[model samples]
Target: MRWRCVTGGLLVVMGLAVVHAALEHDEPIIGVDLDGNLFINTSSSADGHTRRLLLNGVDVLRELTELRQKCAGNVPRTTTTAPSTVAASTAMPVSYTGTVGCQLESVPSNVTHLFGNVSLSFCPLLTAESLKVFNELVYVSGDLKIELNTNLTNVDGLGSITSVGDSFFINSNDALINVAGVGNITSVGGDVDIRYNEALVNVDGLGSITSVGGYLSIFSNPVLDNVDGLRSITDVGGYLSIRANAALTNVDGLGSITIVRGYLGIYGNDALTNVDGLGNITSVEGTLHICSNSQLDTSTVPESVRSLGTCQVITSENCMTC
Candidate 1:
C-alpha cells in the first residue's frame, strides 16, 4: 500500500489540520475531518462550533436525535435584563487605519488623521481640483475605490466624506455626472458599486445613504434617470442588482425598501415602467430576477414580490407572464 501512497502524500503536502485536545478532564475532543468531517465543540473553553456536518451516511445517532429536539427548542428562557442607556461618549469615533494614497499635491499635511484604503486610482493626475485634497478626509476605514478616472467630472470634490468602512467603488468613470461629493454619506459597510458611469444622471448625491451592509449595484449607468436617490433605503444586506440602466424611468426611489437580504435583479433597463417602486418589498432572500426591461409590466411585479421568493420574470416583450 506504500503507506497509502505515503499517507496520501502527507495529505497533499499538509493542508487540512484542525486538532484541539482535552480528554481526561471530562472527555470530549471530536475533531474528525478526513473527507468525513465531524467537529464537535459545544465549548467548555474549547472553541466555537454551532452544528453542521454529517453528510455521506448522515445518521449520526439519528442526527443526535434531531439535535436534541432542536436543542430543546432553542432553550434559554431565563431572562432579566435591562442595562443600556447608550452613552459611550455618544459613540462614533473609530476611524483612522492607515494607507492614504498619492498625488493631488501628494496629500499628507498630517492628512487630517487619515484612515485606510483610498485608492484614488493612483492619481493619473486626477483633477476636479484633484478632488479638493479629499476635502480634508473625515473617515474611510477601508475601500473607497474611484477607478479609471477619465477626466472625472462631478464628485463635488469629495464633500468631506462621512464614513465608508468598506465598499463604495465607482468604476470606469468617463466624466462622471454626479456623486455630489459623498453627499453626507450616512452608512455603507460594503457594496455600493456604481459601474461604468457613462455620464451618470441621477443619484442626487446618494441622498444620504441609509444602509447597505452589502450589495447594491447600479451597473452601466447610461444616463441613469432616477434611483430617486435610493430614498432612505431601509436595508439591503446583500444583492440588489439594477443592471444596464439606459435611462431608467422610475423605481420610485425604491419606495423605502423593506429589506432584501439577497437577489432582486432588475436587468437591462430600457426605460423601466413599473417595479411599482418595489411596493414595500416584503422579502426576497433570493431570486426575483426581472429581466431585460423593455417597459416592464410583469404585472408591475411587487405584490410583495410574488409572495416573497423565487420569481424569474424574464425577457420583456413587456413581461408576457415571464
Candidate 2:
C-alpha cells in the first residue's frame, strides 16, 4: 500500500486498493485515479463506505485548502435543505449605473459591477486622492473611458477592478504618470486602447491581463519606454498594434503572447531596438507589419514567426535584412 501526497502543481496519488487507509477522518483524502479522474472523500456513508465526490480539475488543491480553512474553528456548519433557495439568497447582485464623475463622492462604494458606459474625461479636478472611491469596484460591465484628465496623475483608485466587460480607453492624459493602479485587471472583453498620453512612462501596471477579446492599441505615447508591463498577455482576439512610441526600447514584455487574431503591427517606433520579445508568437491571422523602426535589427525576427498562419509578412526600412 503506497500513499503519495503531492502539493502545489503536482497531483496526489494513492493506491486504489489502499483507499480506506487514506480516508481517515482527520486526513482529507484527495487523489487522482488511473483514469485521471480527481476525487475527494469528505465523509463516510452509513454503510461504512467512503463516498467520493468528483471535483473539477481547475485549482483543485487551492479549492480544497480553502474549504479546510473555512471548516476550521468553532463555527457551526449547517446543511442546506434547498440548494436553489440558498444559492438565490447568497447570489444577490450589486451594480452601479451611468457615467462616473471625477469626484469621489459621485461614485458609490461596495458595488461589484458598473452597468452603464463610464467616462471620466476633461475633469481638471480629478486626481489620485479623489479617485479612491473606485477601490471597491470589482468589475466594469461596459466601456471605461478615461481621457484628457489633465489633473489625474495615477490610477491608484482602480486597483480593485479585476475585469472589464467592454473596451477600456486611456488616452491623451497630459499629467498621467504611473499606471500601476490597474495591476489587478486580468481580462478585457473588448479593445484596450492606450495612446497619446505624454507623461506615461511604462505600462507595468497592466501585467495581470492575460487576454484581450478585441484589439489592443498602444501607440503615440512619446515618452513611454519599455513595455515590460505587458508580459503576461497571452492572446489578442483582434489586432495587436504597437506603433509610434518614440521612447520605447524593447518589446521584451510581449514575449508571452502566442496569438494575434488580427494584424500584428509594429511600426514608427523610433527607439525600438529589440523585437526578440515577439519570438513566442505562433499565429497572426492578419498581416504582420514591421517597418519604419530605425534602430531595430530586422534579422532578429524569430524564425518561428517567419511562416505564421496565412499572413503576409511586411518588413522594411529597419537596420538589417529588410
Candidate 3:
C-alpha cells in the first residue's frame, strides 16, 4: 500500500518489500520548518503466505517523527493581528443628549457643533488635559455645563468659546479655582448660574461677558470676595440674584449693568457692605428686594431703586415686613 499525507508540515514512509534487522541511528533527522507545508507518504507490499518489511524512506520518517516528539511537550501557538487604536484628529463628531462615556485618552481637535448639551458633570477622573479638546471650539449650539468635577482647577482650555446657545451652569465643583477660560464669551442665550464652588475665589475670568438672555445668579460661593468679574454685564432678561456668598464684600463689578427686565435681589450676603456697583443701572422693570445684608451702606442704595417704594431696601435686622 502507498499513501501521502500533507499538512502544516511534511512526512514520508517507504518500502515493505524485504525484512530489515534494525533501524539506523547515524543520520541527522530533519525538523518541521514552520514556514513550509508538511508532506507525508507511505508504501506497503505482501508476498503469498509470507510477510516482509523494509524501511526505504527511513530518513524522512525519522525527521518527521523526531519533530513531532520534540513539540509534544509544548503548548500550541497562534498568530493574529492587533486591533487599532483611536487618534484624536480622526475621530468623528457626535452629539449627545444623555451622558456619553469616552475611554480614549485624547479628545478630537476638529469637533464642531454641539447638537445637544455637553455635560462633563461628576466625572471624577476628568482633568484639564482631557478638556484641551475644547480649546479650539468657538461656539456651543447647546448648553455647556461643567459641574461637580472634583479635580478641575481652571477652565482655561475653553478660552476660545465666544457664545453658548443655552444655559451655562457651572456649580458644585469642589476644587475649581478659576473660570478664566470662558472669559471671551460675550453672551449667553439662557440662564447663567455659578454657585456652590468651594474653592472659587474670583470672577476675573468672566471679564468680557456683557449679557445673559435669562436669569443670572451667583450664590453660595463661600470664599468669593467680589463680583468684579462680571464688569461688562449690561442686561439680564430675568431676575438678577447675588446672594448667600459668605465672603462677598461688594457688587463693585456690576457698575456697567444698565437694565434688569425682571426683579433684582441681593440678600443673605453676610459681609456685603455696599451696592455702589449699581450706580449705572438705569432701570429695573420688576420689583427689587435688598435685605439681610448686615454691612451695606443704606445710604449708598441707588435712588432710582428706592424711589420705587414698591421695593424693599431694609438695612436693619429688626425691620418689619416690606
Candidate 4:
C-alpha cells in the first residue's frame, strides 16, 4: 500500500513512469462496470495501489513505454499510409469512433493533426504517470472520448489529464477518489460530461477552470464529498446537472455559479445539507430541481457556503418542531 503525497494543489503531475513505480501488480487496475456499459470499469484497491494491464501482460507495464513511443511518435510517414489526398507525411484526418489502443511516452506540446474525432474506450492499463503525459503523447485535433473501462479502485493518475478541447466524454470513472486535472484546463470549447464515476471523493483541482463554453454535467459519483472548486463559473451555455451522488454532503465554492441559460438540476443526493455556494441566481430558462436528499441538516452545514438564494434547506433530525 503506497501512499502518494502530491504537493498542495498541484494535481496530476505524476509521470507515467512515476505512477508505474507506485503500482502494485497484485491489484487489478481495471475495474468491474457498476453500470451496463461494458466499456465502463470503475473499481480500485482501497489499499492504495495502482493497477492496469498496459501491455499484453499485467502490471510491470514494460511495454507501455514502447507502445506509447510507437503511437505518439507518428509524425507524417514519409511513404503515405492513407490516400493521395491525405498528406503522405501524416495520418489521415480521421476520428476513430472505436477504441484505439495507445502506448505513448509523452504528450507533446505540438500535435500530429488530421482533422477528425478520436473515440477511445478506456484501455485496461493506464497509470497517473501515463495520463499526466497524455497531452504530450497522443495527437488529436477534434473530439476525444475516454469511457472508463472497468474496475478502477484508485485515484492515482487521474489528475494528470489537463485538457479536452472539443466534446470530451468520460463516463463511469468509478473507483476514482481524486480529480486533479481540472485546475490546469482553461477552457473546454466543447461539452464536458463526467457521469457515474461512483467512487470519486474529492474536487481538489477544479478551482482553475473558469468556464465551460458547453455543457457541464456531474452525476452519480457516490463517494464524492466536495464541490469546492466550482466558484468562478459565471456562465454555461448548456445544461448543468448534478444528481445521485449518494454520499455527497455539500455544493460549496460557487458564490458565482448562480446564472445559467439552461436547466439546473440537483436531485437524489441523500447526504447533502446545503446549496449555500449558489450565488445570486435570479432566473433559469429551464427547470431547477434541488430536492429529495433525506439526511441533509442545514445547521451542521459548513460556513464555506456563500449565497442562500431561495434555498429550501433540509433541517437536521434533532430539530424542535415549533
lDDT (Cα) of model 1: 0.73
Q: For model 4, what is the alpha-carbon lDDT of residue 254?
A: 52
Expressed as tens digits, the lDDT of each residue in 56-105 for candidate 2 is 32333455565555445435568877556544456444688876755557
Per-prediction TM-score? 0.30, 0.68, 0.66, 0.53
Per-prediction tally of clashes: 0, 0, 8, 32
lDDT of 1 by residue, 42-154 (tens): 43443553333233434243455655565566555788899889756643433345665655455643344356788787356686877776666667778888888888787
Instruction: Give the per-residue lDDT of model 3 (tens digit) for 98-152.
Output: 3223332333564544456667788888777777777666778778788888988
- Predictions in order: lDDT: 0.73, 0.80, 0.74, 0.54
Q: How many backbone clashes does candidate 2 have?
A: 0
For model 4, the stretches where C-alpha displacement exceeds 4 angstroms are 1-118, 132-141, 151-163, 296-322
Count of clashing pairs, candidate 4: 32
Worst 10 residues of 3 by lDDT: 44-53
Deviation (Å) of 221 in candidate 3? 0.8
Model 3, residue 17: C-alpha shift (Å): 99
Q: In terms of lDDT, which candidate is strongest?
A: 2
Q: Give per-residue lDDT, candidate 1, residue 242.
A: 87
Q: Give me candidate 2's TM-score against the actual structure.
A: 0.68
For every candidate, C-alpha RMSD to the true structure in Å: 28.5, 24.2, 18.5, 35.5
Best TM-score goes to which candidate? Answer: 2
